[model samples]
Structures are given as C-alpha cells and as structure tokens.
Target: MRTRTNGIQLLRNGERSVDKQYRGQRIFERLGNVSQAEAEDWLKQRQAAVDAQHANQLREGDEQLFAAAAAKYLTECQQRGVRTLETISYHVQILLPYIGGMRLRDVCNDSLEAFKDARVTEDGVKNITVNRSLEVVRTVLNRAARVWRTNGKPWLSTSPLIEMLDEKGQERPPRPISWGEQAGLISRLPAHLQRMVLYTVNTGARDDNVCGLRWDWEVPVPELQRSVFVIPSEHYKGKRPHVQVLNDVAWSVVQECRGMHDDYVFVYRRERVKNVEDEPVMPYDRIDTMNNTGYQAARKAAGLVGVRIHDLRHTFGQRLREAGVPEEDRALLLGHAIEGMPQHYATSTIARLVDLANSVTQTRDRTTLLRVING
Candidate 1:
C-alpha cells in the first residue's frame, strides 16, 4: 500500500513504518516504503525555500554585511607591494575617521563630494592633502569591486564615489634658490656637509640620497675617471637605477666624507641599517641631529632667508638652466623620466655628468657673480 501526504509518497516495505516530525511537518516512512522519487521531491522543495530566503535578504540592500570589504582591500594593497607602510596607514586612518562604518554601497558620489568640501573648508586641509585622501578611498573601493567580480558577484560594477579633481588651471609659483644665495649657503656649511650640499644643489638629489650615500656604490669608470654615485633602482624615487656624475666640488665632498666614515660614505648613520646577519635595523638619530643643528645653523648664518634643505635641489635645476644646459639634459640630471622612455633609461656616465656640471660652473664669471651677489 502507498499513501501521499503533503506531496510526499510513501509505500509499505513488507510491514514496518515510522512517523517523524521535522520543522512543524509530519512525515511517515516504512522499511523500503519511501521511494527514491519521494526523497528527491522533498530535497528539491527544501532547496527552493532556501533560495527564496537568500533572494529576499539580498533585496534588502543592507550595507552592514559589507564591512569586510575594507579589510579585504587593505590585504590586497599589502600584497601589491606598497613601500611606505606609514603613508598607507595614514590614508587608512583618514578614511576610517570619516567613513569607517559606512558600507561600500552607502558611499556614493554625493557623500564623497561632501567629504571633500568638509576637508577643504572645515578642516582647512590643503588641496594636495585632500586629493591624496580621495585617492585612498578610490583605491580601496576599486579593489573591493575587483574582489567581488573575481568572486562571481555582480552587485558592484565600479566605485561610485571617487573621481579626479580638475587641476587644469592651477599654476604653482616658481621657488628656485638664487645662485648668490647658494654660494653663501654653501660657504657657511661645515666642511663635511659642504660637498653634500653642493652635490645636492648641482644634481637635485633628494635629502635621503645625499645623506644615505655609500662608498661601495661609488664607482670610478675608466672612461670618466671621476667617481659616480650609482643609485640602485630600489633606493631611487623613480624605482630605477641611475648614475649621478660628481663634479670636482661634489667629488671632493665625497672624498672628505669617506675619510670621516670609514665604512659608509656619508657621516650620518643610514636609516634602516643591517647587522652581521644582514637583517635591517631601525633608523639612527644622526641624520635628524645633522638636520636640526648643523644644517639649520649654517642656513641661518648665511642669511639665506626662506631657504630649505630641499631648496638646493631646486637650485640645481635653476643653475642647470642658467648654465645653458638644455631642458632634456636638465631633466635627465634631475632623475626625471623623459617622455617616450621608460623610467629605467641608462643614466649619464660620470665623465659626461662632470662635464655638464663643470660647464655650469665655468660659464659664470666670478666678478660678475660678485656684482650680482653684492646687489
């Protein structure tokens, strides 16, 4: 005998039977009484109910569930090899204070616009700072969308809140140090730092490159005869290898610094040193001490008002132009990438760089330079 109850069919298996209650529903079975057909039908119905429930939950458009998206985005950033952990952490901190609890879907264009306005007017933030903050938000959201797409979810198509801020009309005022000022500043610095300052002024090398210089990296090529600082790609701002030719003055500075620090080229301790086992150690205090006392006192004594340590780099570019070096050569010496070439283009040889620096030094008449300085 067979019986149909709530669309389930049961058959008698010779003589035994059992009754079961599941989820407020009663079911009956006998030994071999419930056919495979009946089991299949029940499973299909249960699955359909589950699917319907899921569809309803998704339709609610709740953002609370997407909190994990930010964490996933941060993990992805770490994997992508972001060099500055402090910079990334700062960006994350700024965004979290503003929208940490908000869902990805809740962050629309309007919300972002309001945030920008608040940052600029209310917080008195600079445009560049605000621009960077927006970039952090945009990167995270874009990463989230990508992760969702990779996981086969279609809920997110793109980041809705972030876009480039228009900067077509804004122009920055020129801020290069004058040649007379450079000479005065150079004269005031201690004999040790004078060469470093000159090299920085001539080549526009950043503070780190100037201070972090090492002797082993200084190679004297036969053709050039003069030693050149070979900045490894990893240490360079462009993340590419480059060679900076040292002029007579700059090379003299290197030699002097070499005498002071036997192992390292520069006197200041390198930020992030390595031990005998070749593990990186924390940055030392020497560089900061040099910057605050020695560098600052020299600048003040020189009477070079409004000058910064980095102004030497600007002076380098300006002096290059004054010396009649072409724009292309100037850009090359500054370690900037030329259009149509990759960032890692071969750097100028030590001889050529020396010639270029010497040309700038030779062209200016000392008497005329004095007249300008006196004026």
Candidate 2:
C-alpha cells in the first residue's frame, strides 16, 4: 500500500517521492521516510530558485522594454519620496505612447524625433515642456545603464546623448501685474482667494508656498513684536529652509485669517447645511493652490488674460525694486538662495527685512511698466 498527497507519495519501502511539474519543469525527488509537509516545503524552495533564475535570464538589455524600466524608475522615485514625482510620472506617461514598447537597447535620440515633432506641431506645447519629458527619458536610461542590474548585468548597455531643442527665444518673460491690475484681479476673486492672492503679492511667495503655509511654522519674535514663518526644505522649492517675513499687508491678512484654521494659515470656508431648519456649519479646509478656478475666473473677469499666478510673485519683486530696496535685501526677502547666509534669520535682520518689505506697501512707490502680452 502507498499513502499519497498532492505531489508526494509514501512508498511501501517507507520512502517518499515527489513527482510534480511546476512552471513546465519536472520536480522529481526522493526522500527517506520524510513527512508530506516536509516534501511540500522542498518543492516551494525549488520553485523560488527556478523563478530567480528565470528572472535573471530575462533581464537582458534587448529583452527589457522601456516600459518596464520606466516602471522600475517610478517605483524608485516613489520610494525616495521625490518632491516632483507626480510631474515626473506625467512626463513618463506622455513618453510611453512613443517609446514604451521599444527595447532599452533601441531607445535613443533618433527614435525620439517623431515624439518631439508631434508634441510641438500637433500638441502645440513649447520646446521647454518637450525638453522636460526628454529629461525624464534620459534619467531613466541613465539609471538603467548605471544603477539597475540583474545577475551582474546592467539593464542598459549605455545611455545615449539626448539633445534638447533650442529654447532661447521660445521662453515667455515673467508678467508682473500693475497695482491697478492687481486691484481689479483681487476685487473679482472670492473673499478667501482674495486673501491668499494678497498674501502671495505681499510676501513674494510661490503658489505652493502660499497655499501650503502652516501655522506651526510661524516663529514669534518678541524683539520685533511680530512672527515670521520658516518653511521646511521638504515644503520649499529651494530644498532649504526658507524664512518668510510678513509685511504690514501680509500680516494684516494673517490677522484677518487668525483662528480660522488650527493648522493652515490660508484655507477655504466650506459651508455645509443639511436642511434649511439647521444652521450652516462652516468648516475651513486647506487650500491646495491659489491658481484654482476662482483665480482663473477672477483673472478672466479682470481682463488680465496674460496674467499667471506666478506673476503675483514678480509683482512683489518689481515693487520692491521700485521702492529702492537693495538687491541683496530683495534676494533675502524673496527667499532666493543667498550664499553664506544662514537659513535662520536674526531678529535684527528680520526687523530690517520687515521694514524693507513694508516699503512696497506705499501706493506712491510704483514703476510704469509696459506689459507685453504674449500671443
């Protein structure tokens, strides 16, 4: 008589044997009086070894697809918590339609020419946008050739020299809104958005910084009788701690929004009412960005068709220059990276910056700029 399991059988001679085909490979082995559970464990180990060997054999440069490499690259980026990972992923998706099926060995500058043409002529995107996508492709190929490897063999033999299109005159100049234009734009926006836009113009902060500003980042200074916000590197564009000194206007905006939200400085008031009989429950939610539909609609209503959210920042910089603020102080106030300057500000330096920032608040300090509208 013989006792049989799924893949193992005990023979009359008190020995066990496994006869099974796994992944098209025959697993045949005999053991001396081993239990069925023990035999199953041996089978599992054999399968894992076979899988590893197959993976190594399939990881050849010519066999691996750019799609696979792109997937791996995205995984690595996500794992590293890359700040611009979302944008990188968007670029990868755009490139995939053209290069996804190509073998890693076949990806090169010549193969990407059609993609560039389609993006420029058909998609009507600027050379800079296309260049950004090409940069992602270059990054993925470089990583495959240098970092990613299997069985001591690189995923790619070498990365090709990917050249970017000439963007010399294709770039759009920054549009700094006039005080009159700012008034028109701000007046057209919703109350909450008006405050956020005003804050950005006053502080020269980017859209992300203004929207992501937190209350906890505010540091009190008894010496100056005011507080300044210090943004962490992770939240800032420069990848360094940035100190934001609020001017009188920005501070007043802060005061208007004080105690509205426990965490965020700028937020949208969302009113909820289930029934007419009940009172409206107003909840303040964090604003993701100042460049939302409200800002766009307001700009449209104000007839500032060429204005962008970033123009608010330029407006502040331009006003500071017109107010006779020095270049170094302007750089510091605008949160531009200055060499040899500490990220943390001294109270005295903060006081001076506050004064300089307050100078732009005067209506008389203005420059007549000829705004060039781009087609």
User: For model 1, how does the per-residue alpha-carbon lDDT over 1-375 read when each residue is reduced to its tens digit?
Assistant: 324444344444344343545445554544444455556565556656666545444542224223345565567667866444447667777667567656677776566677788877898877777777777777767766664553366446666756756544442333455567667877887665776677777668888777666677776666555667778776677877767766777777666665555445656444433454565643323242236566788888987655677667766776777788888767767888777543332334345656777666755434345335534
Clashes of each: 1, 0
Cα lDDT tens digits, model 2, 175-201, are 888778888998999999999889998
| Structure candidate 2, residue pairs in collision | none
Query: Which residues of candidate 2, in runs, are more than 4 Å off?
Result: 1-57, 272-283, 363-367, 370-375
lDDT of each: 0.62, 0.86
**Candidate 1 lDDT trough over 10 residues, lowest sum:** 281-290
Q: Which numbered prediction scores highest in TM-score against the true structure?
A: 2
Per-model TM values vs. the true structure: 0.61, 0.79
lDDT of 2 at 62: 52
The total number of steric clashes, by the backbone 3 Å criterion, in model 1 comes to: 1
Candidate 1: give its CA RMSD in angstroms.
15.1
